[model samples]
Target chain A: MAKKNGLDGYCVPFFDDGNKSKFSLASIDPSSKPFSTGSKETDRERLAEIGVLLDAQQERLHAQRVQRVLLVLQGMDTSGKDGTIRAVFHEVDPLGLRIVPFKAPTPIELAHDFLWRVHAQAPAAGELTIFNRSHYEDVLVPYVLGSLDKEERIRRYGHIRDFERMLAESGTTIVKCMLYISKDEQRERLQARIDDPTKHWKFDVSDLDARKLWNKYQVAYEEALAATSTEYAPWYVIPADSKTHRNVMVGELLLRTFESLKLEFPPAKESLKGVIVE
Target chain B: MAKKNGLDGYCVPFFDDGNKSKFSLASIDPSSKPFSTGSKETDRERLAEIGVLLDAQQERLHAQRVQRVLLVLQGMDTSGKDGTIRAVFHEVDPLGLRIVPFKAPTPIELAHDFLWRVHAQAPAAGELTIFNRSHYEDVLVPYVLGSLDKEERIRRYGHIRDFERMLAESGTTIVKCMLYISKDEQRERLQARIDDPTKHWKFDVSDLDARKLWNKYQVAYEEALAATSTEYAPWYVIPADSKTHRNVMVGELLLRTFESLKLEFPPAKESLKGVIVE
Candidate 1:
């Protein structure tokens, strides 16, 4: 699926056996618009087209009731994870799509294995599920706060890879995207929110603390992505500095993935071939 | 809320202490468009206007995070429960909206009381939830199938009323809607699905059996609506034969309900007043 429109260029190389030195987060420019048509009008037109096609594809997914699709989104604050979902899925039937947002783990969540809460929300048969912020949080937040040691972080990465492999082997298709944005872009977004008091509800004073550790989070993401981007659950680096480009790229990638599934409405029921409703 | 646009005319009268004879489902016309502006184009325009307003209202509800809202939709097969949600919520932010669809119960759901599964899906503070089909099914399906005797059915209605009242007292505002369609409309809709091979996935031969018992189901609905409609959670009958009219009326009713809440974005956080992201 990634081969379409050179999307493969954005996919992280599949993790090798402890040879994770080939990938570097800094090498990718978040502002690049390789998938953009260079015209906002044209890009939006494409996005609308993708929305209609996605709506149709999702209907087939819901009809067949066989395979499951999961999309995991990870990004820094103000990176447009929410925006991407709204734009890309604007036309999909809300009934067929389930969006699960993971907030800070509660005491009960913290009491169990990290995957315990996550596994409970996995997509059912013929379902398309989105994980706004997912199990990756377990690795990202603690490591940046110096709560998780290097050895334990490495072990957690192994656990994630194994968990994802099990899901992929169980009739589920998985795709992960990391919405990449530049520091300067985030500054503008954060400042804009602060400028508008109405948007203050979406901002937090502690978000600045995360900004202070931006470099550390980037390194953590790099390590996690390098260790866990396997053949079954690859991560794509989305250039999200351009909202239009980010939405279009993600839509195109998903369109390609769905097309590969070769989904169709189940064959007409013979029992009702000529039966009339009375 | 129902006072606006004379929507009160469509509301099932509140169930008095024990006098439930004021409401009758058969008195309402399935094809009427009392809310329509006499043109399909105008009705659609109004629906679009309501959609935008609903989007803004939902955002405020989310920002406030102090109140909860639940919309319960009950309907027979092909009554447009799915269609109404798709049309009315098209513009609302998917992040703030949760759509829960209830299908037939599994062994586990049937093992416990019916409300157990529903209570688990109730809206949390700062949420707007829609139950595509709800516990009303416990009454409608069983009564129509002759498995539930009248005495037990009356007990169940009281149980629903008390449960909803408790939710209302706890800060959740609830609105229930029944999509009313004519039996002839159902025949046409079912036949249309049969004529289109791709739609066979949506058609079940059992749906014809339900249609054969249409009168019984209506009686059950009439009794349920009369017994359960109350000040805390009212039931509104939506004439759904005209798809455009059905969408518009539902939109108008919900818009009025939301406006009654006088929802506004929560006051800007004092802590974020002058703090700048660094």
Candidate 2:
């Protein structure tokens, strides 16, 4: 399990037919810093250390070329999804990491099943892929917008679980994280962007419309996470109010996950041990 | 034109119906270092400087989201394409750079016209894409292996020029580089890889077969470059016997291309100027 820094406490309980009521999003405080080392400086130091280790691990993963890793990040607007990616992956080899930002579905995309576009971008062997926002949006967004009924939402959840299980059984190691943040935190972050006129390109009035439905969205996330969290693809509730804490905890969680794989470089080639080139 | 460091001399003369014999690959010395700063330390310092500038330029490119940039790299197997990418792009934002390596075409890729797979990977607006080994391989490899006749090769070259012209007209800024390395340099590099057992994953005895056909490949590259270099997409011969020199020259060439685009950040949105989050 390679558990350290009490990361186990953050794992959402695995879903089962009879355990639906055992997990609640409201039970976890978004502002808590369970994994922090009590100071911002120390937390950043820990992050840098983890970054180096992740770079080495990723190189080995690329060398082995047999397994894949997928990190799925889900959060509300201004909850720091983009910031977390930039900071946490700052030290990873750019050659080995592929970041796919899934935007609103296009006309062609809407014509197909929700997972059609997503399946095409799944990590190939020896690749580490990050989904800035992923197929989870299919369940969360439409349900919150009243376009999906409960019966249909449950079926989509079943589809997601089966699809993810297939990916895991084949060789992918999946980790899903919901970056939980307080409503007050979102308000301040949005206001900061507004204050900086140069950053306006990243802002839109529609973002506020989503914020207005914050509570409803949270409810949607709770249901979706509960229904989809399984032994193969588990979800973690990341307390993300503090940016430094968020980056460190996510890095720690990923480092531990990679460690569990026990990745090693491929055995040295016996045939090439003493060969000479002309 | 943002030219500095005598870069103009390295440009492959623009192709035309009549200047067929004006440019020769043999004329350029692979060991030359016109861009070098005399010492490896100073060259590295200069590379670090360009890396920072490149990072800023790429940030603006991603922010503006109107124009695209594509860098195509081609060379013999051990001419350091992978190493050059790692060194030159070390400081650029990983999110902004997409490195697409073209391996030997798969059966599916072979089923289509040569450009079919390549056109799909063209840089989208606001992207900076690098093709590790590109469509140029179609002309180089097959010609060297006697799989394609001269007439067909000429036709493919025309097809490539038209394809690139369309991409340029549609707002892609293209820069291509052929990493020029002497045969002795390649021999040393291949031998080093063979001697290190851990590096065998990147080596193949078949690479020696290609080395034996080096002269044929050089002639093929000469014909392809002379026929395809154009006003829109230009190719440069990068003398690459010294790794630091190759990275610096390539970096300098790309920096100049990006500078020519005169990219700027999108203007601040008046709508978001004074709004406050509720």
Candidate 3:
């Protein structure tokens, strides 16, 4: 609820509206560089600058030991989630950052509710955490695979809305990004991996099967993002066709979010002023 | 076991040695510059170089997805554990590093065995985790406060040995460092914190009480390190009075530990040979 203004233009419309059919993934272009600085080199430099600022802010957050930050990244194959993390956080200290990549659930994870494991990894006080893929996977994956019915998916989305609301109320700042890429882009990326034997370990043939259901996945994403996007945990659709652009946009968004917190180091201890080290 | 030799001069002898009296905290000089590059400026430069090397090794470990690395840091107040983590891991990818700081136990944690909470935070495969303070706290605190009997302390040490051996056998590389700062050094550090009012948030008057019992804490540390140091899990005594020297030594030690693993990117996948995107 503490989110800054005008970001709503990039947000998926909140689901509070009774007629829920207005939002569409096709409305946004995946190749647009709206957040770019017009020069790739300039954008890279700007991102590095933001990284420095972000690090200072993060240290203040840690020193203050107050708020928590959670960034959730959800994207299709080859959407550059990992690359974005490596680039945007390249300059941030590893001491205060926690990156959790959610993979297919184990038997025990599946035994519990979808949110159980996710809640376990939520950022602690003064911590910054990222989920490479997150609870949204529950809505998107099962829906795309046709294992989840419409009403059940809706119910889960409601649960997510409630969950994020609770986190916000309890002093957490949340940001969710849905990495949007064109089907054509996916084809090129997947084929490149297939052609490069060295990259094969990162590719799975099943990805091709997922590509076959491209439209269905997009629809699933559109619905989930729309329903779960709230003032407390708004979802932003990121244009991720260009890796550098994607990294810059994500970094910029995160810097803005952190600055919104207005973090400062705790006031110097009055008692220690003028005291000397031995 | 993959640890390099000549480094053994800094290592506390493995507890398997029956007689632990030879390892004494008083024997090590906290201000020693054994790993320093002969000049403060040169030592800083060396530390930066090691950061880059550590980053590369960490990436390979992540790509291999086979082994885990755990670094345990224990030191008296202001001994520079946090500073070392920031400076040494400055270049590492945030995605591959996990820093877990163990604090005083919560009600739930107290109900379980001391190692229970620690076991849950151990590094996963392909992870390089640093415990800002660790299970060693369990040993040191109770002994220093006279809450745990000597026999119970010895038993806890056995539990740690068994637990760590299992981690190593299951593919974890463990390194523990006890940052050894002389009581005089601690007094200076504590006084500096007290004098700087901005740092008051980090200081507790109770810290003065701990300083009052400095000798007792040192003896407790000596016993615990001697008891828990093992072939699979070694404890190194880091001379930590000079911040630059401490950072350099820890950086060098970690880089060496990572290099000994011989980690490499997995062999290029053969199945995608000649395949093309689209």
Q: Give TM per candidate.
A: 0.97, 0.96, 0.95
Q: Per-residue lDDT tens digits of candidate 1, residues A122-146?
A: 9999889999999999999999999
Q: On a 0 to 100 scale, what is the lDDT of residue A8 in model 3?
A: 53
- Against the native chain B, each candidate's TM-score is 0.97, 0.97, 0.97
Decreasing lDDT order of the candidates = 1, 2, 3
Residue A12 in candidate 3 has what lDDT? 75
User: lDDT by residue for model 3 over B1-278, one digit each (tens)?
Assistant: 22454576788988886647678878789999899878999998998899899989998888888999999999998888888898899888888899998999999999999999999999999999999999989988888888999899989999999999999999999999988888898888888777667678778767777877788998899899889988899999999999999998888889888988888788876766766555
Q: Candidate 2 on A1-278: residue-level lDDT in tens? A: 21333676677777754555577888889899988999999999999999889988998899999999999999999888888887888788877888888999999999999999999999999999999899989888999899999999989999999999999999999999999999999999889889987787778889999999999999999898888877788889899999998999899988988998999888767877777666
For candidate 1, what is the DockQ-based docking class?
A: medium
Better of 1 and 2 by TM-score: 1
**Residue A236 lDDT (model 2):** 90
Report the poorest 10 consecutive residues by lDDT, candidate 2 chain B: B1-10
CA-based DockQ, model 2: 0.67
Question: In terms of docking quality, how is candidate 3 classified?
Answer: medium
Question: B1-278 in candidate 1: lDDT tens per residue?
Answer: 23433588888888854547878888899999988899999899999999999999998999899899999999989999999999999999888889999999999999999899999999999899999999999999999999999999999999999999999999999999999999999999999999998899998888999999999999999999999988889999999999999999999989999999999897777777776667
Candidate 2 deviant stretches above 4 angstroms: A1-6, B1-6
The C-alpha stretches of model 1 lying farther than 4 A from their native spots are: A1-5, A16-19, B1-5, B17-19
Which fraction of the native contacts appears in each prediction?
0.65, 0.58, 0.73
Which window of 10 residues has the lowest lDDT sum in candidate 3 chain A?
A1-10
